[model samples]
Target: MAAIMENVTFIDSSTCAILISAFKAMQLKKTGRLVLADSPVVQSLIELTRLHTVFEILPNQKSGIIGIDGRVKFAITIIGPVN
Candidate 1:
C-alpha cells in the first residue's frame, strides 16, 4: 500500500483501511515492517496494530532518500504474500 507523512499527522482510520486492503489483496500474515516518518506510538498507529497483527512498527528516517508523492507518514514494503 501507500502512505504520506508530510510535515505532520501519522496513522489514521483511512490509513488503517488502506493497510487492511493491502493485507487482503497481498495476503499478508507474517512479520513486516511499518516505516513511519515519526514514531509508532501515535493514536492511528496504535489503532492500526490493534486491528491488524502482521507488521512491526519502526521509525523511518530515510523518507527523504525515497521519492514519494504528496507527504508520507508511513510506508510498507511487502514483496509478496506473507503466508
Candidate 2:
C-alpha cells in the first residue's frame, strides 16, 4: 500500500496501531493512497510512537473560494478510504 499524507493531522497509538495493521494488510493487496492532514496533535502522537515516516505526508492545499474569509479557509479533499 502507498501512503499519501497531506494537510495537517495525526492520531493516537490506538488509532495508529489499527492503521498500521490495515497498511500491512493493504500492502499485500494493491497500492493505494495514505493521505495525512496537517494535524500536529496527530502528527506528534505518531512521532512519539515512532510512526511519523511510516505514513506518507502530503502538505498541500487547493486554493478556492469557500465563503470563509477570502483565502483564510481552504477546503481539502482526502483521496482515500478510511476504512
Candidate 3:
C-alpha cells in the first residue's frame, strides 16, 4: 500500500476523505496496517474525525501507525512525536 501526505500537519476533510476512500478501496483485510506520517494536518484531521474507535493515534504522527478492520470492532495505529 502507498502512504499519502507522508506527514500531515493539518487535518482536513480532504485528507480524511482520502483515507476513508483508500481504506474502503483497500477493502477489508485480515492483516493490514495504515501508517500516518508525522504531520499536523493529519493530527488535526483525526481530532476532527473522532475516529479513535477505529484507529490508534500516536503521540508523533511521523513515526509510524497501524490500522485494522474488525467486524466487531476497529483498529488504528498512530506514530510520531506529537500526541
What is the C-alpha local distance difference test score of each model?
0.47, 0.48, 0.49
lDDT value, residue 8 of candidate 1: 48
**Reference-based TM-score of each model:** 0.41, 0.52, 0.52
Off by over 4 Å in 3: 2-11, 29-31, 60-83
Ranked by TM-score from best down, the candidates are 2, 3, 1
Ranking by lDDT: 3, 2, 1
lDDT of 2 by residue, 1-83 (tens): 22433344544578777767776666666456354344456566766776655654333434332333332332222233355
Winner on TM-score (1 vs 3): 3
Where is model 3 poorest over a 10-residue stretch in terms of lDDT? 66-75
Off by over 4 Å in 2: 1-11, 62-83
Q: Which model is ahead, 1 or 2, in terms of lDDT?
A: 2
In candidate 1, what are the lDDT values of residues 1-83, reduced to their tens digit?
34444454444677667666766665545544343443344535645467524544433434443335533334434334534
Worst 10 residues of 2 by lDDT: 70-79
